[model samples]
Target: MSTASPHLQGSQSVATGPKSHPRLEIRNIHRYFDGRAVVDDVSLQIQAGQVTCLLGPSGCGKSTTLRMIAGVEMQDSGEIYVDGKLICDTMFRVPPERREIGLMFQDFALFPHLSVADNVAFGLKGSKDEKRLRVEELLQKVSLTRFIDDYPHQLSGGEQQRVALARALAPRPRIMLMDEPFSGLDNRLRDGIRDETLTLLKEEDTAVLLVTHEPEEAMRMADEIALMRGGKIVQQGAPYNVYTRPSDKASVAFFSDINVLKSQVNGALADTPFGQFLAPGIADRTDVDIVFRPQHVRIDFDRAGKGPLPTATDGVPARAVVKRARYLGHESLVEFQMDYDGSVLKVTVPRVFLPEVGRVMWLTVPRNRCFVFPA
Candidate 1:
């Protein structure tokens, strides 16, 4: 509950990424169904050879938006471009088969009767030997060349997924759209296949727009993530920036443990329950919310006679009771109740800082380490 004295410095830098430009663009896309906007003015671009994940809760328009791009579902009004060529507009709508876009649905969509080679060749239009060559090459790329003659039922879930991907890539489409590509497999297989799939996509030089509801999956796989909420994109950025420096309260607390402290901005200092935090006028407003990660809070044992200020720090004091203590091998999470506002807060500390249960400790948080946004 005690606020750490402010000491750390903060840095601001421009958002930067690879120099590649986007290859697929969805401009002012709007899709409506059953008298509601399933996709509301959603627009995003995916660069070639990079994975762009559309992440959100269920019913957040991610799948619908992807389906719209694939021509599986028609948008009420919008434009879809593939490699800078207009494919969908109000006047003309391209059929899914003619869009030159590969689709990997949630079901994997492998035909039960077709062998791996036959399934991959289903997308190709060529002589028998040419289709066979393409299928065999893709099979090797996905590490499934040995399963060429095997039926879909004979393969493991991961193998089937690899086959599905190979089939999608057979025609060498301009873009690939994947809907929860690894959802059905067990955790272990899912992790392995996720890595393998990404490697295959990179090797194939395929631009992909993947849709998933899992944050961990998005963080691990995506070069950039576009987070959706209520049929709109709430935020989109690289994984680290989206997770650490979120723009709003909804985004900050969506998938992380955040301590939202009420603070008043005054020139360089913001007063919170913990202490007077040093905050530059980043928000450029008098009233704003300061968000701090529990992991950034530094806690140390308070000895009876060590520091000059016995129980107070920088004219601010924290009275807290150690409510809970948990050790998880690499680190420990400590929880306490702040006396100032009766708020429960937690701090993740390295294993070396493990304090005993019911122990009283003082904590300090450098203001610059926290982020501020409008409440």
Candidate 2:
């Protein structure tokens, strides 16, 4: 497969839409196989020069949605529009090549027989000079101009990946579809390459829809995140909004480790070892889970075997014995056994603060940080 290429000067422009139309839009797209809905009513929009990440776990229909948008796989039902112009639907369709969409996948897929310049120029159509100029411009943009004459086998993995990126951008695609494009690189190389790729894509002013299962990748690269699950988009928002204000317990758990305290709601409140948590609107006697991340749990030294005083935000402090603690480079993860209940709760403390096992510690969960979800 060919990687997407950057736009050439004077190449045909994509169809324009009214000022209100997004750069790319999918309306209630659905795809199914073997009587199962692989992609269910997934819809999203991407503005020019923005990056939207389709984030989810494996088998969650992320790739299926990308394929449908690329026009590689037809959706069972829905419409795909570019610049408010209908490009695809059940009855009307546009060829993948004509849609001016660029594609880059996990594998670089550079042609073994071609040089870096040729590979980048593979998707270009014009005079010889025009193609060469386009390839050179893209190579320079990716910082691979020095290796233009080298073959794929001669370059390092990172270099090869840059070549793929250059080739993808060479065609000057209006929209770029990347499916785990950075997963193939080593951890050390992935971050740098990802940053570079983001810069180039943004400079080109191309709307991008990147599909990845890694939350870290989505958080780092996306301007907007579409959280997918069971073939549906569970949430869509800015990374900070989505991470800090998740819609459900599962959404909270997806981004990081969470400590859940289960309790029955009574009088719009759920009582726990920490304190009473407001669960307004939940019926009385309904089971609810109070969720908070490990990082949000504040640790305090025991005051003569007594916990700290309760506050409106921090709530009442609870005593727990440290069960285990491990230093994880940047932070230390400490597991605690609650004195009231034998349940284990994990807490992440910044830097190195490894308390010995059986050490008593006071724990408090900020009331504002806790999420009350029905069990």
Candidate 3:
């Protein structure tokens, strides 16, 4: 996916950010049903002209948050702000028509009975000539000008998605909210539609908030990601930052795979089965868990004289026999069993450096790279 549009400045651009207000804020939003809290005290902010992705598993309240922002569902207690204006509040429920927001759904919610042009013009509130012009402009913007007269049933999935997007944009709403816009298409079509949708949204300078569960999808499309769990936002930040420096174990596991090492706290030195490792500080507690990515663990099969030693500042002595090695095009994923650890660690290395299956190797952990947190 392409980077954020050049028009999207940093987060501090409230006074000078894109066409909308400094930001779109969802503050302390709560929603419940059947006496169960589906969305509990969640909040997020979307910058103008940047995609803020709401990512979580199913039933995590992501769709409910989108619906509340679109005025389709009422919030139990929070407020929705657009360009700094209060559009949603518990006391004053604004009708969907008056929200001045654009909504694109996963099903391509189009009118089968209406032609493409008429379907887009359905949301427009203007004279016949003005509505016709708006529809024509949007159709051209979405590259569906040739299919303008085709009925929804005759159009392809991508074409239908484009039509839905065109209809959402016909009113020129200040903000746009999309719920899984590419959920129904095949992989090839989904990728194309995603790129096309993003391009059009950028050209129009529309502020967007996309809800999705696919990690790669969110990483590719979002300028920032808000990871939700248990009815609230557990963490939110730039994709790289959130992926590399997660605040908690749950947040870390949510984005990527990791290996946790058990360490014994002894002042500044943490002793482990692999080797004696030192860190910045340690709690008085005797037990701690350290997490690190597979790429960070350097593998050594050849050592000078004393065999491979755990000489790394915080390295561990992991005696593992290579169990399996799968060669990918550019890299190979090597899985091995570490002595009696009861867990296998998979190391990803360049395909050019392949090791025999029965050979043993030393596993080293860098002191500063390991992430330590409460178990």
Candidate 4:
């Protein structure tokens, strides 16, 4: 098997809609189980034809939030709006079927006895001619027109997911809620399916709120990402913004492997093995973590115990001995034992670079890439 590249936005480009009126708006939503807040004060907005992903780890309340929006679970507090009209709140409620919202679950949930066309047309309310026309159109859009009469069991996992998508869209819903809809598909098929599904949703002019625990999935499918943790949004932004300008050290580590150096703040600077880091907004004498991703760490040969000249971008080099190296197909991960404190640091290089375990090298982390946070 071959290694896959990271998923990014624009794998399937489509026309973007104006944000004059959000198709779906969730305001300060909260849900509790046994006095513990499971979905706490979550708020987001998704414009028509836009995809926003609620990204977090498992049990972080992403699915629960989606369920509340779908009307399967009611929020203890907060409001849900569609097209700027209040649809759900503590005092008022709207049934799931009446909300004009479509949902696609991870399992697809297709009826075993129903044909593809019938499944798509199941909830549709129209004349026989209208229902058939809508189902046929969706089938064509999903490129499953030839299997219109096939049952769910006869289709592959990816095909079943497409059929599920068609069914969710057949009613021309104003909003779509998807909960890890592509997780069941094989990894090789996931990227292609996500691109195709996103294209279809955009063309249909539906606002999409997708829930996924995978950061790569969020980056691939979301026009915007709401990074959730412990039932609250920690950060929300475009994939690039969230990935590059993280709010904290944990945020930086969430996207990829991180190398951390523990240090103490004296005055306004934190001294680490690599170099001194500007620790603004932090109190004096406080401990801080100097965080940088592996890719930002540059490794060079140790020539006569001296290394590359220090610059504004690349900080002063620190001596380290290679402990272990592993090739991860597309990239290589090397672990180094820092000579400063005998601590281990991991670095990821775009290309393969493996040296003897005991070899000594100089490592310098780019100053711009390091994020200083309170430890």
Candidate 5:
């Protein structure tokens, strides 16, 4: 949120501190397979002590971009730089093992035959005492010092993950690449481990690029999120900015359930059941979509078959018949059929508020909460 120098180009957005080199930077990275581009012109910058999530659905090139940055998979084009020094490009390359980059995947990948301390010390260099000291320090940081002599088979899934993290950090890598590293843990353990891992990574001041398809995970872990789709980043910014001010309808839908109202633009305005929405630059007769999340729809009791009067902020209320209602843990979701067009719309209310099917209610949407996009 506190960006020093912000730059925007097409769909890509990057913010960097002034007069400081980013710990990891990739420019126009492309990767192809079977004559199809798996990664296309992907670019991002991660500063030290920052976590940037490359977030998207499956097969959206998030993993490929991470692999390219880790130096395990070469990009077809583009350049990789660390501290303003070029590490990889079309003509030069840095081997994965020599790149000083740490990698953690869904699988712990620790050797069952080796002790925990030995596994962590595998990447360290120095005398026996120094290596042991480094391993002990990392184990303590991960809160596994007591299990230093235990093998991977002796540890639980979460313990094994902590060991893997310790092993990756023992070498003091400047950059850490994580590919759905918490996917293996159960929901109960996943949250705790994620927080712990984040704290450890930040303490080490490592630039982390995490690849995740889960929007919740990205929002929870990322200092900045680069939303990827079809091998390209469509939006990149702080989690709040990316969510509150999306680039398009698809971007909005990616974060949560969305309800769309379709209308034709006339005189820079689109008429909906609630009221007219301002479509500033849209041409007359052009089709447009008014998109808003379910939570933004306000519900009120209907009196004598009439709804609330129109207001400047919230437009006129419209009558809707309840089609169904389900109580989700944190909120109640109610689906409704509009009296105006019979179109279905969903609204979410906090806590348990379940109305019987066929019950009538009035709904109003705040004009400012809606997004008008060309259809």
Candidate 6:
């Protein structure tokens, strides 16, 4: 939903920029409950007009980190800053409302009794006319001007979410913290609403910290992704870098299905049924896990009961019998039983290609596509 700038009115100057100070910054954040750490030493910086997503599975402390930044929950140890000014510490703190931050949760927490306009203008600080103008401007920006007088109960789920977004942006908060804000909507509705929400946030130029378990959501909305697990951020970077160059097998598996080959390191190399992977710097006798995604596997048809010749890229060809094949909508998944040890490997091809069970094929993994890690 592209619209004119709502933050500017006639002579009022619109603040658009990467401000000198970060809009929000958390340093060495840690939160604990009952002697157990839920958020352990997490830190991130979000500049003005940028979106940073806290991405991970449920119970990975993403929500806790967002809550701490929102001033609803204080970090047991660490400092929270806004505009380079300290807003909260273990003892000192600002209240949630005074933090100049907005929050949108999964439930769309709209006031059912209040009209849409009133709900949007609830937190806005100005004269009556100014508040009404701000509400109208936001409603129009979100394409909900026609329903301004209706109550929350009368609006659809997507409309209610739009209202919530309008409310959050009406106050022009410096930073917005969202916890799975679109999870309640259907898949189709979620995508449209997410795009609209992102547009509004960009127009308003407020930093956003979104918490979600879905990897696709983070990839769509985040300028930077912070992947969390077990109460710590294991990886943080652009979505492409995080997806293509993962720090560990779990990081790779988080984005897609992976095939793992477990082996013991002997003389800095781990030998597997497929081939040997160079595990440099690994201690002798240490267990290592060689991992690759299904798409990285190349399949060759067995002709005359023979396989393709070996090459440097695909070091060795491992012959396997087709165990099962499934034709997905856009691609096909084929599982194979390796001849060396009968271990199973999965490969995905672009279009429909189905082979009967017990048919033999050669599976070769490109060395560059494989990630070697300690098991």
> What Cα-based lDDT does every candidate model obtain?
0.79, 0.89, 0.77, 0.88, 0.90, 0.88
Model 3 regions lying over 4 Å from their true place: 1-23, 273-282, 303-317, 328-331, 340-342, 350-354
Residue 341's lDDT in candidate 3: 70
| Model 2 worst lDDT window (10 residues) | 1-10
How should the candidates be ordered by TM-score, best one leading? 5, 4, 2, 6, 1, 3
What does candidate 1's lDDT look like per residue over 1-375, in tens digits? 112224434323323336655578999998888889889988898877878899988899999999889998888998999877888988898899998899997789999989889999996998999999999999998889888999999998888989999999999987899999889988888988899889988887788899999889998998888999989987887887677656676776676688877866676677775566665544444666777778877665657722224233233445665888888788888898766777888898877455666777666655555766655
Tell me which of candidates 5 and 6 scores higher on TM-score.
Answer: 5
Quickly count the clashes in candidate 4.
0
lDDT by residue (45-133, candidate 5, tens digit) is 89998999999999999998888888878899999999888999989998889889999999989998999999999979999999999
* Better candidate by TM-score, 3 or 4: 4
Give the per-residue lDDT digits (tens) of candidate 6, residues 1-375: 111112111222123354487889899999999999999999998888888889999999999999899887889999999999999998899889899999999998998889999999997888999999999999999999999999999999999999999998888899999999999998889999999999989889899999999999999998888999999999888877677667888888999999988888898778876667777777889877888899989999998888888886787888899999999999999999999887889899999989999998998988877877788
* Local accuracy of candidate 3 as per-residue lDDT tens digits, 276-363: 5544445555466667676667777745422365454645556677888877888888877777575688778865656888777777
- Reference-based TM-score, model 6: 0.92
Give the number of colliding residue pairs in candidate 2: 14
lDDT at position 81, candidate 5? 97
TM-score for model 5? 0.95
What lDDT tens digits, residue by residue, belong to model 2 across residues 184-303?
899999999999999999999999999999999999999889999999999888888778767788888999999999899899888999888887778899888888899989999888
Full-model lDDT, candidate 4: 0.88
After best superposition, candidate 5 residue 161: deviation in angstroms? 1.0
lDDT for model 1:
0.79
What would you estimate as the lDDT of candidate 2? Answer: 0.89
Stretches of model 4 off by over 4 angstroms after superposition: 1-19
As for TM-score, the candidate ahead, 3 or 6, is 6
Q: Where does candidate 4 clash, by residue pair?
A: none
Off by over 4 Å in 2: 1-19
- How do all models score by TM-score? 0.86, 0.94, 0.86, 0.95, 0.95, 0.92
